[model samples]
Target: MRTLNVSISDIEYNKFGLKGEQLTFTDFVDMVSKELTRQKLNKCLQLADKYSLSKITMEEITNEVKAVRQDAKNRN
Candidate 1:
């Protein structure tokens, strides 16, 4: 594995120390990535919920749009 040497603030170092020896940089990065993904997903869900679109599946949305386009073509 490649090693990276970057400077971190004293506060950041102390905060990481609180995680103890069991937590390696890889573990920390994995944990942070998961947390960031979760937060982004939650924000997307919140926006969808606000728009009353949370109840609809992605497939349903795709189908609905396709149906509308087909209907428009049929009218023309």
Candidate 2:
């Protein structure tokens, strides 16, 4: 329900696929939010791969989660 005036370079405009496209404020916000989420997920995946966490077994991961939860519960 508000208006914001943002400026971007020609390259960025095209990269966002907004060149010659008419998008509503909500649509633009949604697009940008999705892109941000995707980037964060990709970064996490890269770090997990780098640390060899990507190959972690489900049982090990579950046990780790349970231990963390128990530790948090004890703190509370």
Candidate 3:
């Protein structure tokens, strides 16, 4: 097992609502992972909107995905 150290100002820590809270390393890692995933998803959504892909319907997306999968399976 290893230990990690982090420093946060009192004001900033409380501002982020972490004051008096206890979090294990695992919890910290999970929080960081979730935040990263959220950021990536938001970026992808922004890109989709920028490229006008946001107008695509769910059924169209699903069919396109299925077609690609079937094509790949046939190649194998």
Candidate 4:
């Protein structure tokens, strides 16, 4: 979800069973994160296909939030 990386030099480069493949723990985590995102997106797409839902634009969402904040300010 966030672009954060860790470097632990004490661990051997090929500590993972993938010998000859120079992949670090951070690299492995990043690869898994990408795969998880892809799988989640695919699942959401499948669910969307099975159901009908209304979608709102980013601008519409932002405007609604702004309106709510303004109303709250007025109430106070």
Q: What's the count of clashing pairs in each model shown?
A: 0, 0, 0, 0
At residue 67, candidate 4 shows an lDDT of 100
How well is each residue in 1-76 modelled by candidate 4, as lDDT tens digits? 4544445443534443344435566778886687689889998887866764226567987999999999999999
Q: Tell me the lDDT of candidate 2.
A: 0.89
- Put down candidate 3 lDDT per residue, 1-76, tens digits, no spaces: 6777778789857654674556788878886787789889999999999999999999999999999999999999
Q: What is the TM-score of each candidate against the true structure?
A: 0.51, 0.73, 0.75, 0.45
Clashes of 4: 0
The most accurate candidate by TM-score is: 3
What does the lDDT come to for candidate 1?
A: 0.79
The digit string of per-residue lDDT tens for model 2 on 1-76 reads 6767778888888778785646688888898998899999999999999999999999999999999999999999
Which candidate would rank higher by TM-score, 3 or 4?
3
* Residue 47, model 1: Cα distance from true site in angstroms: 0.5
Order the numbered candidates by TM-score, best leading. Answer: 3, 2, 1, 4
**lDDT order of candidates, top first:** 2, 3, 1, 4
- What lDDT is obtained when candidate 3 is compared to the true structure? 0.84
Model 2 spans > 4 angstroms off? 1-15, 18-20
Q: Which stretches of candidate 3 lie over 4 Å from their true place?
A: 9-16
Q: Which ten residues in a row have the lowest lDDT in candidate 2?
A: 14-23
Clashing residue pairs, backbone N/CA/C < 3 A, model 4: none
Better of 1 and 4 by lDDT: 1
After superposing candidate 4, which stretches have Cα over 4 Å from the reference?
Answer: 1-20, 54-76
